[model samples]
Target: MLNMLGISAGIAVAAYGEARFDAFGVMLQLVTITAEATRLVLIQILLTGATPPPAPAPAQADRDVEMGLLGGESSASRPVMKPQPGS
Candidate 1:
């Protein structure tokens, strides 16, 4: 028999690691890091940026996305969409 198991790890990880896995956040991070690392290497192997890199933004910035998923009606304090008369 084929069985599927749904562990809470994914949910927990997503909740905790939103910045790294989120599209708007870390999707570009991999690409950018690679380029920066390569450029730094080319220019000077020992060169390093003095200032720290900016903090990564969460892919799912709004917690409402997870909250609103219970149904079409979103309970998030911040409305992702304008409230319409009806669906």
Candidate 2:
């Protein structure tokens, strides 16, 4: 809030110095235009936050089913493959 006021004051002073009073008024309009756009963008980003989409649910397996649809049933878990940069 205060930051925007500072910016407004600075622009008013500078525009008045560089141009006439009418031109300064025109420049001030631009300040409000940009400030409004900035405020809206900030509000949208803040409301959304950094939320990630929910992941899909895992497929449920039946213990009594005995085997996978592919007929491959392993008592041990699958090995986790670590990636190598070159390979």
Candidate 3:
């Protein structure tokens, strides 16, 4: 809010200081500045408004139940096999 006001004031001052000021040029500058500011504000709103979903604690509980049903042994709990002494 303050930043935009400062930028607009600066442009107005610059335009006032110019001896051969062009109304159309100043109008275009103001329009472009407004558009860019709007774009930035919208982007900030979208980024901060969105949030990721929470962790799946229920899914982990389901997996624990499945492991219990499977004789307390899942593929992940199995030990790796070592190479035989021969062959």
Candidate 4:
């Protein structure tokens, strides 16, 4: 809301400051800005509504070995040796 107001004020200031203001040219500029804003908004909407691509499935063998889920020895079960007292 604040940004829109700032943009509107800026455009108004620019148009008002023009020494030789042409009504037709000003109108054209306003229309162009409106069209560009609309185009950007539509592009944003389309992009946000778009669906992402499907992810590929893992191999059957790879799936079975996942974290010992199938009752097999998993990498997580490996024992780690602690360092001796001194160094």
Number of the top lDDT candidate = 3
User: What lDDT tens digits, residue by residue, belong to model 2 across residues 1-87?
Assistant: 999999999999898866655776788999999999999988888898966677533432353134565576533345667999998
Local distance difference test, each candidate:
0.61, 0.72, 0.83, 0.79
Residue 12, model 4, lDDT: 93
RMSD of each: 24.5, 16.1, 14.8, 15.2
**Which runs of model 3 end up more than 4 angstroms from their true locations?**
1-17, 50-87
Q: Residue 9 in candidate 3 has what lDDT?
A: 100
Give the poorly placed runs of model 1, Cα more than 4 Å off. Answer: 1-21, 45-87
TM-score quality measure for candidate 2:
0.33
Least well predicted 10-residue stretch by lDDT in candidate 3? 70-79
Which candidate ranks first by TM-score, i.e. highest?
4
lDDT by residue for model 1 over 1-87, one digit each (tens)?
Answer: 123233565667677886555576765888899999998776674455355567544644344455567554434345576778885
Q: What lDDT is obtained when candidate 2 is compared to the true structure?
A: 0.72
lDDT (0-100) at residue 56 of candidate 1? 41
Model 3 scores a C-alpha lDDT of: 0.83
* TM-score, cand. 3: 0.35
The whole-model C-alpha lDDT of candidate 4 against the native structure comes to 0.79
